[model samples]
Target: MLAVLLVTSCTSSSASGEQGDDAKPRSTSSARPAPPRKPVALTIAPGDRAAGVEPGAPVTIAAVDGKVTQVLVVNEAGQPVAGVLSPDATTWQTTEPLGFGKTYTATATGRGTDGKDATVTSVFSTAAPRVKADLSMNPLDGQVVGVGQPLAFYFDAPVANKAAAQQAIQVHSEPAAEGAFYWYSDKEVHWRPKEYWAAGTRITINASIYGRDFGNGVYGNDSRTAVVTVGDAVVANADGATHQMTVTVNGAVVRTIPISMGKPGHETPVGTYVVMSEHTDYTMDSSTYGVPADAANGYRTTVAVASRMSNSGIFYHSAPWSVGDQGHRNVSHGCINMTTENARWLQSISNKGDVIVVQNSGGPVLESWDGLGDWQVPWDQWAAGGKK
Candidate 1:
């Protein structure tokens, strides 16, 4: 009985060994192959489901181990956002900034070297602006102005980002007026052509500031436009040494009149100027121009036929007291003094932007910022001032 049991045990052991060997071969042959790996991957910036993103933040989509095939970005209204694809077609980014408190979606597709495709979609929202600035323009719509008139903008609030603010404003002219924008102050900016505007030229300014960020949580409220038409060229040439004033219309000398300029200590400024305003009767105050009324050579008198030619209290007005000096010698406080009849006639024919060139004066040249002295700046310097 013991011998029989031993033989049976041996047979069972052999059978178990055979089964183990067979199972090992079956497991090796029937094991599932590893899942195929993806050939391309896409990544969207700001990530999917992002919130409170800055409106000026850049939005981009990039491909990995592949090239971008297509990309589309749209706002909540389904309007497509403008963007540019990379030259190699590996990435895409938005061109303009997004609006505040707005939701945007981006979808991108890419193809791998293995001929497989991959896609990704992202959604995000921009934060609302805490402060906003509004802008207004001068020259009024459809107004006819003189060649020396400047295109100016006034901001309701001070702009910290002057570069960005200037970028939002664009100026265009019919015959291509080359100009530059000069920031006179925090809230004011002015633009003037390299030279005076050609007669009958059309000027337009487009201020696309809406949705533009100006730093420190400040954004632009709305956009604006200003259009102006240039009229005939009226120029006045004054010779301080000869005490003569010549008026020209479209390059033709229309009239010449005797005039008296500044005395020795109060010589007139030489350079180009523009007529700012006209007044049938105006009071001349020495205090207004920084000269105290109690000081020597200071006078406060009311006069007829006055035309404001500068911000520093300079004018072309009647000064009958100095009639003997007219056309003979320069003797007056610092103005172009003429007969009442001639002053009235000149005032009647001149408009707000007429050019006035003062030559052969003893004083320094007029400053470019002194009441429409933009013509005093050279074209190269003016253009360089606008470089970003």
Candidate 2:
């Protein structure tokens, strides 16, 4: 009986040990649940760390399976690049062209359907230009000019892509004027309305050519703006046959001065012209106009109240020596000879761009490319010359 009890106790103890082992807890530290995934994907053009990008290249940022919340693009100078975002908020793109040799940074934020946010960043640089073209404008900013004034641009280098160059310039005028740009040569262009600009017109020119490529390793250097105000319309009518000049301000005759024009061989040109410049005193030298001082018809003298009417050295000036021929016959070289008082009065009232019309002259008609004689070109011809 003692041996049976001992064996039984040993069995019970073994069973109890087994039970204890089975009841003990097992560790779950090695097993874990996976993390949630990002809901949005971001893409940027001219991708991160990109180089040698074109200035006019497109810049864009887009989000997939999500909506774009914010985007910011800036240059090294910290100026914000102008851009527009789609209404659905999926993409954003730049509006204006970028500058050459500039480093730009872009940052974007997006939100996913799961309410998670994603942010992305990119840095890039534009290619530098080997050559650059600079612009020089006429009728400079903030000046009040006459009706016949034209907006002119002179490029430092010849532009091979005339159409592209013309597209870079924009003009806006208050009171609404219809105009077109005419290329006089590869390096020069001018813009004018079909008729003279209306008095009280306000004009603005935006030359947004920076970064524009003009073939042959040339690019635009910078952008510019010009604002001009139009003053009264001062028009002068000169009759070579009658030898009289009628000056009018806004269609009302202001002065009728007896004048002497060019002689038979050196007759003044017919057609319209603009007053390019004025001087209180100017030296009229025959040599300046390719006429030798020793020639029979050549004369050199300094005169007061000289107003340049053409690029060919024609002027309306005070000529006391020709007083006898005034109002009767055409005398002197290809200039309007008038009394000192009349010439001074005309200069005092006339501003740059005033209209001067010479008629019934036995001379060649004015050429369109001659000294701001833009009106000489018909409206249809001028419009055809623009970016077609």
Candidate 3:
């Protein structure tokens, strides 16, 4: 019997174990898809709750394998710190300095390649210096000075790292002059050109000392700028042999004055001098320099006009008492004595930084530490920085 065709035709089951042909196969592997890529680590300098951090230390936020998206840094006073973010948003840096002895807060946010966010925060305090060095500069800002003037700086606290101090003080001049810095002491420094400054030169000094380490726990207190203008090239060359002073202006001889310089025992120093100051109706007291007014060589003389040339008691003032010896021989004590009229005329034409050269005086050379004796040292020696 066809036996009802006994056709138990066996059709294969679907790969999905379903009866329909449209059924899809199922995955048998148990492995899940690889996890999303991890984000880059974010770092902030002066880590959280840091203390005694240098104000000038790089207050920065950086990331690797990620990008910085935003940043905020503020002082305790609610003042925001100035900062700049990298163009690629990978780093943030502080542009302005932080205040000392104050707590600061910083927040930075970043995003990783996995599309994840990273946030970081820091609370830090800047170091408080044991001592702050006060800075003083000359020539005064916007003042006019003569060509021989050197830009001088004085620090109240001694600087152990003098080279760093010297680097912080920069001098810029128009028609650039070859110059160098000479340190007279731990707290004093002066900058001068190899030759006298050219008339009409403009000079600017930048003292970026704030946050600088001067060593010995000393720190700079502030930053400053000074602008000075150089005026006429007024020079006075005094000859102890000729007993005359030839005054020149801009390389032209302007006047010839009969003068009596220091006596044999107290000869004027033979070197260059820069005019320091001018006085009107001032009294010259010998006791100021330890010479008693009652002493034989000491006298309290008052003058109408006087131009102080040296710190150790020297001036070309109205010494009418020595007018009789003018143009004749050395008679005064370590000063160029001149007539009152001539002295007044000299005062009228003089300004700070003017040059006064004493030649053939037979006295010892001027000490570099004396007054403004920056020109006393040869250029080669002066350019050697100093014994710092």
Clashes of each: 0, 0, 0
Q: What is the C-alpha lDDT of each candidate?
A: 0.82, 0.86, 0.87
Ranking by TM-score: 3, 2, 1
Model 1 alpha-carbon miss at residue 340, Å: 2.4
lDDT of 1 by residue, 156-236 (tens): 877778888888888999989878887777777888887888988998888988767777777777888878888888888
Ten-residue stretch with the least lDDT total in model 2: 1-10
Per-residue CA lDDT of candidate 3, range 231-313, in tens? Answer: 99999999999999999999999999999998988899989999999888879988877789999988788888789898988
Error of 1 at 372 (Å): 1.5
Model 1: residues with Cα > 4 Å off, grouped in runs: 1-131, 156-160, 185-187, 386-388
State TM-scores per candidate.
0.67, 0.79, 0.80
TM-score of 2: 0.79
Which 10-residue span in candidate 1 carries the lowest summed lDDT?
A: 1-10
lDDT of 2 by residue, 1-388 (tens): 1121211121223544554423533322332444454498989998999987768667999998788999899999999999998999899999988888999999999998668999999999987878789999988889888899989999998888787778889999999999988888878989999999998899999987777776676777777898999988899999998899999998899899999998999999998999999997799988878888789877789998799888888899999999999999998798999999999999888889899999987888998777878889989999888433
Error of model 1, residue 12, in angstroms:
87
Best-to-worst ranking by lDDT: 3, 2, 1
